[model samples]
Target: MRLFILGLGYSAGHFVRKFGGAFSHVAGTVRDPAKRNDLAGIEVHAFSGSRPGDATLERISEADVLLVSIPPGNGGDPAIAAFADVLAERRRKIIYLSTIGVYGDHGGAWVDESTPPQAAFERTRLRLAAEQAWTNNGSGHVAILRLAGIYGPGRNALVTLRAGTARRIVKPGQVFNRIHADDIASAIMAAILHGRGGTWNVCDDEPAPPQDVIAYAAQLMGVAPPPEEAFETAEMSAMARSFYASSARVSNAKLKCEFGVTLAYPTYREALDALWRAGEGR
Candidate 1:
């Protein structure tokens, strides 16, 4: 099997590390030609332009599986906008990495794949629109994984705590779901192997408060938890504060039942503990 990735960012990179061995050929696009060295064996193509060049399209056409992890810009999905026609004709299995934010402020209510999107922000609206575009333009089976806040290795709360940027901002009754990077890769691999088509929520078993996660990370690191600041009085950027607006407990029932996935890090505590032991925060 040949696998091609549109954006080899963090999550997609993890996917490659976990599953690239299964494919006979692997290639991906990166915005910077200078970072080609970082991609190791995979063929790296320049994708910094408005549309993929002829060489990139040739790579896209040669793949048996494709994963898109790029966010939509104002002009919309770069891949879909550029090669929707070509993609519609390919027999490739496609997966689009999307966010759980599309479900919008559920008032801490539980949500699943069946719930209709009620996007609360322009970013999420764009994601929803991009998802629809892929669904409409593509003849191949597309599995959309609506992921939660992703954390692993250098990107978790332990790193934030060590950096002295960990903040315990208390928002009463507000909770958010999260998934470890390895789990995200695992879920994607499951989707690829099963050839499932449709939307699925990819997250851990627990939905927790932001403050609680930070506190737990602190405990694991043997450090004092950051001082609490009520959300109303906290000094934060608009983007950071906007995350609190969508308080939903995302369910992973579909991921487990439909895809038969067993998450490597089923909860934030498990992931944080493992990262801490591995000295990821240090």
Candidate 2:
């Protein structure tokens, strides 16, 4: 199979790293090709949501599978807008990475694929529109994978605590769903194999308080946990604070049942344990 990725981001890049050998050809787009030398052995092209290079266009034309990891902007999906002709002319398996934030402020309740998207933020509203656009007009089967907070390898709480940047923000009754990058790759593979367009939640089994995660990492490192700051008075960026606006335990039962896959890290504890063993912080 030939694979082409719209945004070779952290999770999508991890997918390629894990499964590139399965494909005969692998190519992807980054905003800047010059800085992506680390993506050796895979064709890297430049595409900042407009005016894709000829090489990128050629790869898209040749791809048998397409993974879109880029979020929609104010103007909507760049891939759909830029490559309408190329995509519409051919059939390819498409995997779109969406976020569980579309469920919007579920008040710490559990949300599943069947729940209607609330989309309290404009960005998530744009995501919802982009998802519909792909399903409505995509040339072939489109798998919409709604993901949770992602962490893995060098990007986990362990590394943050070691770097002295970990924060323990306390919010009453606030819980968040998270997924390891490895499991995200698994979900991508499953979506490719399933081949029947559908939406599924991609997350671990836990819906945990944010502070507990930092404290656990500190414990693993034999260091004191960062002091906790109440959400109401915590100093955080707008985007960071915005995340606390919604709390939902997203269910991935559909992913497990339909894809017939087992998560390597089923919860944050298992994931942290595995990361610690892998020397992520030490």
Write down the lDDT of every candidate, Cα atoms only: 0.89, 0.92
Q: Cα deviation of 212 in candidate 2 (Å)?
A: 0.7
TM-score of each: 0.97, 0.98
Screening candidate 2 with a backbone cut-off below 3 angstroms (N, C-alpha, C), the clashing residue pairs are: none
lDDT tens digits by residue: candidate 2, 1-282: 999999999999999899999999999989988887679888888889878878788899899999999889999998889987788878999999999889998889888999999978899899999999889777999999999999999999999998889999999999999999999999999999895998999999989999999989888888999999999999999999999999988999999999997999998999999999989899
Error of 1 at 197 (Å): 0.8
Worst 10 residues of 2 by lDDT: 33-42
What lDDT does candidate 2 reach at residue 188? 96
Point to the candidate with the largest lDDT: 2
